[model samples]
Target chain A: MSLDAATKPHEQLAEYLATDMEAVNRMIRARMASEHAPRIPEVTAHLVEAGGKRLRPMLTLAAARLCGYDGPYHVHLASTVEFIHTATLLHDDVVDESDQRRGRPTANLLWDNTSSVLVGDYLFARSFQLMVETGSLRVLDILANAAATIAEGEVLQLTAARNLETTEEIYLKVVRGKTAALFSAATEVGGVIAGADEAVVKALFDYGDALGISFQIVDDLLDYAGTEATGKDIGDDFREGKLTLPVIRAVAAADPSEREFWTRTFGKGRIAEGDLETALALFAKYDTLEATRRDAVLWADRAKAALDAVPEHDLRQMLADLADYVVARLR
Target chain B: MSLDAATKPHEQLAEYLATDMEAVNRMIRARMASEHAPRIPEVTAHLVEAGGKRLRPMLTLAAARLCGYDGPYHVHLASTVEFIHTATLLHDDVVDESDQRRGRPTANLLWDNTSSVLVGDYLFARSFQLMVETGSLRVLDILANAAATIAEGEVLQLTAARNLETTEEIYLKVVRGKTAALFSAATEVGGVIAGADEAVVKALFDYGDALGISFQIVDDLLDYAGTEATGKDIGDDFREGKLTLPVIRAVAAADPSEREFWTRTFGKGRIAEGDLETALALFAKYDTLEATRRDAVLWADRAKAALDAVPEHDLRQMLADLADYVVARLR
Candidate 1:
C-alpha cells in the first residue's frame, strides 16, 4: 500500500520515519548476514522481509526524533529493537508450533525448528551487539531487562496456556511480557539515548506500555472476532488452550453448564467439533468479548494520556493517534 | 571423586579460586531464579547442579585476578560466562537431540525440548543482563560477538554436519564456534573488565582461543578413545554424522573401498550394527586417532605459549597446566 493509502497511524508513522527506518532496515540486513552460516540469513530473510509493519522500530525512531536526537545511535537502537522483535517471533513460532505467520509460512515450516531456534539466537546476539554500539549503559540496561522479560513471559505462557485457573492478573503479566516489554523498552531507550530527562523517558515508557497492552488485548479479541487475513484464525487461541482475557473473563462469569463446557474444552483438553462455535456463543452470552474490547480502549486512552507529560510535538501526536489506531482496528 | 582427589588442573584452579568460585556459584543461583516461571529453575537446576567443572567461569575469574583486578564486577562477569555456557548446553542438547550429558540425562531428555529451548533462551537473556552490569562497553562487545559466533557456529554445524564434502577447514570453523568462541570471550572479557593493556588482553584472548580448541579436540578424541564416564560414548559422533578431526583425517586418507564405506555410513546415514567397529578399524588403519591426539597436544602447547606474553603468576601456571591436562585424560 502506498503512503497515501495508509489509513493506520503506524503506517503514517512508518511513512514519516521512512528514511531512518531504511537505515534500520539496512543495518538489520548487514547484521543478520553470517560468513559461515548461509542458513542464518536465509531464515532471517523469510521473516524480516515478510512485510509486517515495522511498528516497534518506528517507535524507537519516533521517540528519538521527539527528543531531538541527532546522533547515529537512534538508528542502532531501532535496529536493535527490530532484531529483538524478530528473534522473539522466531522463537514464539517454535514454541507455538505455528505454521503460518503474517499470512506466510513460518521459518520453522520453511526451514526447520532447529534453524528457527539457532537463527533466533543469532539475531538476539546481534541485537545486543547493536545496543552496545549506542554507548549508553542505561539503554543497554533497559533493553536487556526487556529481553529477559520477553523470555520470561513466554515461559510463563507455556505453563499457563492450558490451565483454567489462570487469572486476568497473570494474563496481563503475560501480555506485558510478550508485547509491552519490547514496546516500552523500544521507546524508553530512544528517549534515554537522546538524553531526554527522566520525566520524558518515563512518559515514553508509560505510553508504549499502555499501547502495547491495548494492542495485544485487541489481538486476543480479534482471534474470536474472526480476522483470518491477519493469519490469526478464529479459535486459534482457543484450540491452543490459551487463557486469554476474553476466555478468562468468560470463565469467571460462567454458570455450572458453561463452566463444564470450558472445563471439558479448555481445562481438560477435550475439544470436540463445533466447540469453537459453542465457545463463541458462551462469549456472547457473557459479553466477554465486548468487555475485553472495552479494556483495550481503556488502555489505549491511558496510552494517549501518558503522552501529555512530554512536550508537544508532531511525533507525540502521531504516537497518541497510534495508540488510538490500535483499538480502532477493532471497529 | 572427592575434592582432595580431584587431580585435574582445572580442579586445582577451582581450588585456587574457591572463595571467588563460591561467589560465582551464589550469583549463578541468584540470577537463574524466575518468580513467574518455576519451570525455568527446575530445568536450569537439572543442568546446573549436575556437577560441571565450572571451568569457563573459572577462566574469567583467573584472568581477572591474574591481572590484579580485585573488583566485584569480575564475579558478575564470571557468573555471566557460566550462564552463557550453561545456556548453550541446554540449547545444544535440544539441537543435538541428545539424551545424556556429563553421565546424566540431559535437560531435553529429562524435561522436554520446549523447556530446554525456552529455558536456554531465558538464561541467555539473563547472561546479557549480567554482562551489561559490568558497564564496560568493550566487555559487552567481546561477549556479544562471541555469543553471535556461537550461534553462527551452531547454524553452520547444522548445515555442515552430515555432508561428506565437509573439509578440515570447515570442521575447524565449527569447532571454534561451538567450543572456543565462548572460551576466548570468557577469558578476554575478564582481562578487558580488569582494564588490562592491549598486549595482556590479546594474550588472554589467544590463551583462551588455543585452550578452547585444544579442549574440544580432546573431547572429540576421547569420544572415540572409549571413555564412557565422560558421557560421550564411542561412535556417538559417528552416529550423529559429525565430521570431527579423526573422521575428517580418516576420510582424507581413505582408499576406494573405505571411501565407499565412509560415504555410505556418514554421508548417506546408513549406519549398521557393525559400523562403529568398522569406523574404529578405519581410524586404526590410518592412525587418525593418534593423529588427532597429536593435533590436540599441538594446540595445547600453543595455548601454553600464549601465556608467555603475560606476567608470571600462580593462576597463569594453573592455566598452562590445564591445557596439558585436557589431553592427558586420553592417555
Candidate 2:
C-alpha cells in the first residue's frame, strides 16, 4: 500500500512550500524545548506533537517566504503561531471540559486544569520572547492584537455556547476573532516582517482572512459529516451544543417537531441517545451541509482571488493550493 | 498634625520617589485605556483601580531613577510590571478559589473564572505590548523570564497546596517564583534600561529579591499576629490550610496532641470552629511567629544592605526606607 514516492503528499507540494513546511516543523520542535520546566515541555508536546496538520504556522511561514523574506526570524514567527495555537487549545480543552482531542486524552485530563493553565501561560510567555527576538515592533503589535482577539473570540464562543440566536454576523465575528484573526495575523506579519509593500501586506491579510473564514465554515459543516482522516467525529458541534453554521441553517429550516427536537437536544436537559442521527437528518433535509460547503467554496475562491491582486510568484501558487487544501475535505 | 512643615518619614530621601510613584500611576492609567474593546478597559481597570500598594512597579520606577536614569521609558517598565502583577493576581484568585481580595470581591467572584482567566490573558498581552514599546530586548528578556518564573511559582503553589511535606527549600522556591522573581526582575530591568553596569543590576536584583522575601515573611507573620492597619484577620492562613513558615515550624515543634490537630486540621478536613485559636496558641507556644519575624527582619536588613553596595543617592536612601516600610508593621 506504499504510495509511489512521486505520489506522496509531501512530494506533491510545489518545491519551495515543501521546504518551508519542513522548516516550520524543525523550528517548532527546537523552540518548544525548555530546560527550566519539565512540565511545560511535557504538557506542550501533547498538542504540538499531535500532528494536527500544522496549518496555521504554515500560513505564517509560507507568507513570509512568499513576501521575499530572507531573514532568519520567520522561523521564530512560525513557532510563535504554533505556540499561540497550542496555548489556546490547552485553555479550550479546560473550558470545554472535553476529555479527548485528536483521539488522545487532553492535557487537562492527563494533568489537572491547573497544569494546563500554567503551561499555557508559560507558552504565551515563550511566544512573547520569540516575537521579541524578531525586533519588529509592528510584529509585536499585530501578534498582541491577535492574541487579544483570539481570547475575545473564545469568550464570545463561551457565552454563545447554548444560545440559538447566534446570527451570521456574530458567528463571523467569532470566527474572525477566534480563527481568522490569528490566521490573518500570521500571514499579515509574514508580509510585514519581510518589508513587503503595504499593498502586498494588505493582500496577504485579506487572503489569509478569507481562507480562514472558508476553513472555519468547512469545519463547522464537517463536524456533522467529516470522516476519521479529518480527526473529528461526526456531530461534534451538535453534541457540544455549539450553534455553528450548520445548526444555524438547520434551525432556520426546522419545522415545529424539529424545533422541539432541537430544543430537547441542545437546550433542554434530556439528551436522548440517537440525537446526533436526528440532528444529522435535519441537516441533510435542510441541505445545510451542502449550503455550508458552497459557502466554503465561495470564500475559498475569494481567498484565491485576493491573492490574484498580490504580486505573483511560486509561493502565490502554493498559497492558492493551500486555500484549496483548507476546504479540500469539504468537497 | 501639620507635620508637612517638617520632614516626613523618608522625606529627605523619598521625596523624589514619592514624585516618581505618582508618575507610574499616571502611566498605568493612560496605558490601560483602550478604545477598541470597551470590555478590555473595564476588566483591566477593575484590578488596576483596586488600590494595591503598587510595590512591584514602584520597584521598577525607583530602581531606574536611583541608577541616575531619567528616561521616560521607565514609566513603560513600571506599567508593565503592574500589568504583570495584576494579571497574576487575577489568575491567583481563580486558582485559590478566592471570593475576597484585599477586602473586596475578587475578579473571579465579581465575574467568573472564565472572565478572570481570559482577562488575565488580555492583560498579559497588553503588558507585552507595553514592554515591546520600550524597545529594549534586555527588558523583554528580564520581564519574560520573570513572567515564566511567576507562572511556575504559582503552579508550584497549586501542586503544593494541602501537602504537609512541603520543605523549606520547596517553600522558598515557590515564594521566589511567585513573588521575588518579579520584584527582582523589576529592579534588574530598571538598572538594565538605565544602562547601568551589570554589577548594579545584580545588586538591585538582590535588593528586590530580599525585599520581596522579607515582605512575604512579614505577610505570613501578620496572618498570625497584627492589627487592623496591617490587615491581619488572625489565623486566616491556618483556616485556609496554607502551611506558612510559622505553621510549618509549629508542626515540627508539635507534640502528640498537636500532631493530631495538624492531621485533623490540615491533612483531614475536620478543622473545628476554634481551630484557628488553637493554631495561634500553638504558634505562640513554639514561638514560631517570633522566629519568622526574626527571619523577615534578617532579610529586610539584607535588603537594606544591598543598596550600600550601590552608589549613594537620595533615591537609594528612599529604597532603603521602602524596605524598612515593608517590615515596619511587625516591629
Candidate 3:
C-alpha cells in the first residue's frame, strides 16, 4: 500500500482505496448473480473479472473519500460505475465485431452476440438498481444523462466514421460523449453522494472530464503509435475506418493525392496491406500525431489544474499524477 | 369514442385516451431527437412511428387514468414505457437477426447492426432520463427491477432455445422475462406514479402479467395457426427453433420417435423444409396446440379476474375485454 513512484498512478490509487475497492468488487459479484439465468453471470464474469485497471470505480471512490466523507454508499456508487463501464464494453465489442478485449476473447466472441447484448442489458439494469439503492435523485439524474451522452457519442462516432468531413469540434464532442461523460459522472456522483459543496463537485467533474479526454486522445494516438500496453493492434482504428483526432487532422491538411488516398482508404473502406504504414506516414508528414499528442498534454494539464480547488490530500495528488500518467503513455 | 364491442379493446382504450396518447407520441418524437447524432432519431423513428399499436404505452395510460389520478407525469410515464419497448425491439431484432418488424423492414436491416445496437442504447438511456424526470424513486425501483427481469428472461430464452428439455416452467420464466416483465412494469409503474394503494398496484401488476402471458401464448399459437392479422409468418418461430409454449407442450407429450424429431429439428437446429409441416402435424396429433389455447384462455381469465380487485371503471372493463381479445385472435 506504499506510494511507489515507479508504479502506475492507478495502482497507487488502488492501494490507497484498497478497502473500498474490495467492497466494490464484492458488491459487483453479489449483484451480478441471477436466480434463473446462469448465462447472465457467465458473460458478465468474463469481462468483469478480466484484469481491467478498475480505473473508473477508483475515481468514484477517490472523489468521495477526498471530500472527507465516510459512508458505505461510496462502495455502492463505485460498483454502479463499474457495472456501467462493463455493460458498455460488452455492447461495444458486439457493435465493433471485436474479437479481443482486455487481452482476452470478447464476450461476443466467447459467447454469442445475443448473450452479450442481453447480459449487457442485465448489467445496465443492475447498475440502475444499484444507483436507486442510494436513493439520491441527483445521482440518478447525473448517471442517466451520462448514459444518454455515451450512447449518443457512440452513434455519432458510427455515423462520423471514415467521413473526411469530420471536424475537430465533432471529435471533441464524440470524445466527451463516449469517454468523458461517464468519467465526469462517475466523479460528480461520488461528490454529490458525499454531500460535497458545489465548488468541490464542479472541481471533481472538471478533473474527470479533462482526464477522460486526455485518456481517449492518448488512446487514439497509440492506435497508430503501436503500443503493446493497450492490447490493441496498431492501426486497428484505421482498419475500422474510425476518424480519430490524428486522422481527422491529417485529412484536414491533405493535398489532392493525399486526399484521394484518405478517401480510398478511409471513406470508401478499401483498406489494403500497408495501409497502416501509409496512414502513419501521413501522420508523420502532417505532424498530426504530434498535434494530437499536444492536445492530450493540454487536457492533462487542465485536469491537474482543476484539482487546485480541492483540499490537499494524498488521493488528490495521485489523481493529478493519474492525469499526467494518461498522457505520459504517448512517450 | 364509443366502447363498441365490435372494435378491439386496445383500440377502444386508445380512443378513450386519445389526448394522452397524442401527448405521448409528441414526447416520444421530441425526446428521440439528437442534435449531433441524426442516426439516433432515424433508427428510432423507423420503429417508433411505424404504425405500432403502441399497446405497451396505452396500457400505462389506461392504468394511470383508471387509478383516478390525474397528473402530467403520466404522459411522461407512457412515453418512458414506449421508449423502453422500442429500445428492446431494436436490440431484439439485432439479436434475432430479424428482417421485418411490425411487417416492415427492421432498422437493423435498413441500417447495420451497429446502428440498431447504438440507437437502442440511446433509447434505453432516453427512457431512463424520462423516468428520472418523474422524480419518483418508487417508480424507478419498479422499472429497474422490471428491466432486470426483462433482460434475465431474454438471456434465459437464449440459453434455452432449441433445447428439448426446456420445461413449461422454464418457458413461463422466459415469457415473463421477455414479455410480461415490461407489461407488468408498465401497469405497475402507472399505478405507482398515481400513488395508488398497494392492493391496486398489485392488481395492476397481476393484470399486466396475465395479459402478457396470454398475449404471448396466443401469438405462439398463431405462429402455428397462420393468421395474417398478427403480421407474422406462420412457422417463423419453428423455423428459428424457438421453444414456445406449443413446442414445449408438444415435446412433453412427445413419444420416442417424436422426441427424436424434436431433437433433430430443435435441439440440433437441423430444420428442413418439411419439418414445419411435421411439427404442426405432431401438434395436432397430440392436441398440444389445443392445450396451449386452453392455457392462453386460462391466463386471459386470470387477467380479467385480477381486474375485479380494482374499482369498477370503464377503463377496467375495457382492460378485461382487452385480455379476452388477446386470446380472441386464436379463435
Candidate 4:
C-alpha cells in the first residue's frame, strides 16, 4: 500500500469535491421529492440521509474537473448517478430482506417492501429525468445502458448464488454489471459532458471500470477477513450462500470431502454452527483469500495503467491514489 | 353510439393499428431479452405473450398516426410505453401479492418476488433505452415524468389503501398517477415525436388522460357489478381493503351505523362472512356504485370532448369510440 493512501484518499477526494458534492446533494434532495406522494420523499430521505461514502458521484465530479469541464451539468450528471445508485440500493435491500444499511434500518425494514419497491421505482424514474435534463443523447445512452446492465448483473448474481458451477468468468461479468457498469458510466458521462476527446472518455471509463472491479474484489475478500469498517457483516457472503470470489476459488481447489462441505453449506443451505470458521479455514488452506487479494491488486494496477492516457494532473493523481486506497485495507 | 361501436372499439383499434402493433410486439420481444439472464426473458414472455390487449402502446401508435406521423420512431415510442406498463404490472403483482394476472399465475407466484422486482427493473431500464434511441429529449422528458407519476400514484395508493378518510380528490389523484399519467404521456409523446401542433398535442394528452381515468373507474365499478369479463375478481378490492372510488363515496356519505360497518371491515380488517355483501348493500343505499358509474361516464365524455381539436382521421374516430366502449359495459 502507498504511504499517502494511509491518510484515506477517499476522504481527500471528498474534501476536494465538497462544493460539487453539495450541489449534487441539493439536486438529489430536490429531485427525490414528490409533491403528491409524501411517502416517496420519506422513504428516499431515510436512505439518502444515511451516510455512505458518495464515491460514485465523486468519481464523476473528479473526472469532469480533470477533463477541464466548467459547465453546470456535471452536477446534474453526478446527481443522476447517485439517484441510480440509491434506487438500486433500495431494491437490493428488499431483495436481500435486509434490515440494516449504513448502520441504520433499511428502507425496507423501516417501511414495508412495498414502499421500498415503489420508492425505488420512483427514484429510477427521477434519475432518468435528471439525466435527460443534461440534453446529451450520448450521456442518456451511456447511463441508460448502465442501468440495464446493473439489473442484468443482479439477476445473474441471483441465479449464480449458491451455485458451485459459477466460474470466475461469470463472476467478472456480474461484477462488471453490478458495480463497474455504474462506475464506468459515471466517469464516462462526466467526460462526455465536458466534450472531452473520445480517447480521454474511454480512458476515464476504463479507469472507473477497473477501479470498481478492484473495489468489489477487495470487498469480497474483506467479507472473509473480518474487517470492522467494511460496513458488511463478516462472512456475510458465506452465510448468505453467495459464491463470491474466495469461496469460488476454494471450491474449485477443494478435495472431495471439502467439496461435500461446500455442497452442504452453499448448495444445500445446511450452514451449521462453526461452519463459517471451517469455511474460513478452507479459504486459508487453499490460499484463496490471498489469490483474491492478488486479483484486486492486479485490477488496481490496471486502473492506474488506464490513467496513463489521461493528462497528468492532480485530480488524475488522486484518482490513481483512490484505486490504491480501495485495496489498501488489505495491507 | 355508432353502429360499429357495438363491437369492441379496442379490438377495432387493434385491427386498425395491426401493422404498428406487430412492430411494437416485435420490439417488446426483442428488448425484453437478456443474453446473460435467461430468467428475464422467461418471466417477461409469460406476461407479453399473454392475450391481454396491447392498449397503451396502441394509444401511442394511434395518436402518432392521427397526427400524420409516417416515421418509424412512433413504433419505438409505442414499444417503450408498453414496456413501462408491463414493468409496472410486474411490480404491482409483487406489491399486491397476487397469485394471478391475465387469467394465469402471476410472475411472482411462478418465479418469485425477487425475480419479479429485478425483471421489472430491467424492463424499465430497457424502456428508457428504447425511448432514448428515438433521439427525442421531449419524448424522454414526457415518458420519464410519466414513469415517476406512476410510481408516485402507486405509493400514494399504498399509503391510502385501508384508510376510510381517503377522499374523492385523493382517489382521483391516485387514479391520475397510476393510470392517466402514463396514458397521457404515451399519447403526448406520440404527437411530440410527430411534430404535431401544440393544440393537437395538448388534445391528445387530454384525451389519453381522461380515457385512462375513465378506464380505471370502470374497472373499480365492475368489481362491485359482478362482471366476469372484468378480468378482476369480484370484491377483490374489498378483500384487500383497498378504498376505491365507490368505497370512498360510501364512506363520505356514511351514517354512524354504516361508518361502523366500514370501520370493522376496512379500518380494523376484521372482515367476516357476508361483509362484502353487506358492503355492497351499503354501496347500493348510498348509491355510490351508480355514482361511480356516472363519474366514469363523465370522464369518458370528457375524453371524447378532448378529441375535438385532433385531426379528423380514422384513428381519431376509433380513439373517441374507444372512450365510449370503456363505459359501454356499465350500460
Checking candidate 3 for backbone clashes, the offending pairs are: none
For model 2 chain B, give the 10-residue run with minimal summed lDDT.
Answer: B1-10
- Candidate 2 global TM-score: 0.82
TM-score of each: 0.96, 0.82, 0.96, 0.96
lDDT of 4: 0.89
| Model 2 clashing residue pairs (backbone) | none
Predicted structure 3, TM vs. truth: 0.96
Q: Which stretches of candidate 4 lie above 4 Å from their native place?
A: A1-7, A98-104, A229-231, B2-7, B98-104
* Residue lDDT tens for model 2, A1-331: 1132343222334355667667777777776665544567788888888887677777787788788788888878988998899988877766655222333477877886667778888888878888888888789888988887787776677666667777777788889877999989989999998999998899999998999899889888778778888778777677667788888888777889998887877765367788888888888898988888888999989889889767777667767876777677664
What is the alpha-carbon RMSD of candidate 2 to the true structure?
Answer: 5.0
Error of 1 at B219 (Å): 0.8
lDDT tens digits, residues A1-331, model 1? 1223446688778888899999988999999999889999899998899888989999999999999989999999999999999998888766666312333467777787788888999999999999888888888889889988998998898899779999999999999999999999999998998899999999999998999999999998889995756656677788778899889988999989899999999887788989999999988888999999999999999999999988788888889888878887786
- Over B225-312, each residue of candidate 2 has an lDDT whose tens digit, in order, gives 8888876687666666676798788888889989889988876657788888888888889999889888888998998888987767
Candidate 4, B1-331: lDDT as tens digits: 5745455888888989899898888888999989999999999998899978888999999999999999999999998998898899989877877312333478887888788899999999999999988999999999999998899999998888788888889999999999999999989998999999999999999999999999999988888895666556788788777889889988888899889999989887788999999999989888998889899999999999999999989887889888988898776
lDDT (Cα, tens digit) per residue for candidate 1, span B97-189: 632233346777787767888888899999988988888888888999999999999998888877888998998899899999999998898
Q: Write the per-residue lDDT of candidate 3 for residues A1-331, one digit (tens) a residue.
A: 2234578899889999999999999999999999899998888898889879999999999999999889889888999999989989988988877322333477787877788788888999999999999999899999999999999999998889878899999999999999999999999988999999999999999999999999999988888885687667787788778899889988989999999999999999898888888888999999999999999999999999999988789999899989988987787
Candidate 3 per-residue lDDT, tens place, B1-331, comes to 2334567888888899999999999999999999999988888888988998999999998899999979899999899989989989988977877322334466777887788888888888889899999999998898989989999998888888888889999999999998998999999988988888899999999999999999888877888885677677888788677898888888888899999999999998788889999999999898888899999999999999999888778999889989888888876
